[model samples]
Target: MSQLTGPVPDTVFPRLGWVDDLVVPALREAVGALPAAEARVAGYHRGWTEADGAPVESTPRRGKAVRPALTLLSALAVGGSARDALPGAVAVELVHDFTLLHDDVIDGDALRRHRPAAWSVFGTSAAVLAGDALLVAAMRAVSDVPCRSAAAVAELVGALMELVEGQSADVAFEEAPAVSVPQYLGMAGGKTGSLMGCACALGGVLAGADGERVGGLREFGRRLGVAFQCADDVLGIWGRSRRSGKPVGSDLAARKKSLPVVAALAGEGAAARELRALYASPHPLAEQEVVVARELVERAGGREAAEEEARRQLAEALRALSYARPSADVYRQLQEIAWAMVRRDA
Candidate 1:
């Protein structure tokens, strides 16, 4: 087993290679049961196949598969075998992909994972249908888990609802005159945190963990997810294109009300005033305006504030890990994972 005591993995399989052997094949098994068209879209979105469903030359899978890995790790943290949590892992990964598919459609983002998004290649309707199919498949996978797995199914459903609500709020925020930091955090918690919490909780439920510890794992994942989002918000405007797979200021170009933007607009300074005026226009930011917006965000201290929030949430996540009462090694492993979530360079 590869050690799980570092930052997030860059490759499809982390140095923690255990997930490669277990999670990938099981995810394939779950997705393999879908109809041909949905499967093709799913496969392509997952980087498992070309847009036509033909196999791609072997390369690192586009995503880090972090949610699935967290599910399996939660199983281990709860003193259960990773194999026993395969269904949960598969369900989490499917749900994540489902969200990404719809998110691209909603955001009108043409790229994903450094390539054309599924909706960009396939029709938007087809991508939406594929996302719907994945949702069904995810629920089916959860239900297949042995004994008392009903809880897992319910939790996944709850997360999906929460995710939808967050996404809805996000859409609304774009047109709203002002959005508070608290509102942004709440949206981030739901949009990103809910499923992450569900990933850990489902693992615990499937592994037969008790309610208290399972709940603890849920909170831990929830906090970590917020941290992850904070990092992502920072990256959205400032991250390197080669590492992030998206051009710098992509979020700015879209006029997204991301955390940093909201935080910056909260400022009382000249830069913040200028930024608010720039963002008030209904149209997307022009290319040069994106550059100006980046500068305004930094000048208004949004970047530092967002980065600090990420650190704060990371600490909170570690503190919450106490409730899970994992073994020393497991505790340390989770600590590493929490750090990675907030500290990712991409």
Candidate 2:
């Protein structure tokens, strides 16, 4: 395994090109193992081809591939080669996409990565099967790892279980009358935190880090994951509005109990009261109502609360990194990456 970069550079997306070089090729190979029908849907979802399975002449659609970055960085952090953790990186990325596929279906989201979701392109059943296939591929991909394969499999399976639990709780919260801050954090932990934790832990395992060190890395990633979600919830509402002054997104439109909304509803202000009433209404909010809800959340202090929580979680993530006792260079890279999770604009 070759070291991709000597240190973090001026580019905002550090090592993303390295991720593309390693993970994308491996992912393409994994997806090729699927049957043609399932492969077509998976390929389309990954932005590799058209719906009909033709190669994309233009730019291929892709997400940030952040999970794989964490995996590789964690290996480096624990004194292992980035290339040694490629299996873990590939596994985590596959699992991440699996969740996205199912989430789009569960959320009734037609668009993903700024285009039609797999469920929309192929029927719901086909999309689901493709996601399922991807998951199996993920498990298979990691099971062959030369380093601590059993432990790696255990980490991946544990994260999958947590993800399912979080997703179930998220769906249930849609109809629940009240969602406590603790409850929401727990959900976010299961839904998003677990995989990130696994990503980091798997890297440590591949690096042959001790149990204590692996545990620290996992904690760091878990806390960072929650912070990431907090930032994401806030961005979902206000990222675009930073320039336009209009908070908008599908999360608000669907009234998902995201961190910001839950934080706001927990407030005692008049804006919070109005927000509660609006959420309790049987009728779905109109487009204008979405804007009102965004404002109400801000005025009620939900946005501030979420932002505060994000900072606190970021601190905890950094603290956990300290416990892992990485080299100073690794610490700087990990710290920068964790901060980036909360500081992203999109």
Q: For each candidate in the order shown, give its overall lDDT on alpha carbons.
A: 0.84, 0.84
The list of candidate 1 runs beyond 4 A from truth reads 1-13, 61-63, 242-244
lDDT of 1 by residue, 1-346 (tens): 1111124455333555677678888888777889989989999998889987789898874336778878888888899888888899899889999999999999888888888999999989989999999999999988887686788888899999999998988889888889999999899889999999889888788889999989988998888888888888888887664233666688998888888889999999999999989998889899999999999998998888888888888788878778987878878777776766666564
Clashes (backbone N, CA, C under 3 Å), per candidate, total: 0, 0
Q: Candidate 1 at residue 159, lDDT?
A: 92
Give the number of the best model, judged by TM-score.
1
lDDT of 2 by residue, 2-77 (tens): 1111122335464567667878888899999888888889999888888888998996424367788889889998
Q: Estimate each model's TM-score.
A: 0.94, 0.93
Which stretches of candidate 2 lie above 4 Å from their native place? Answer: 1-10, 60-63, 241-247
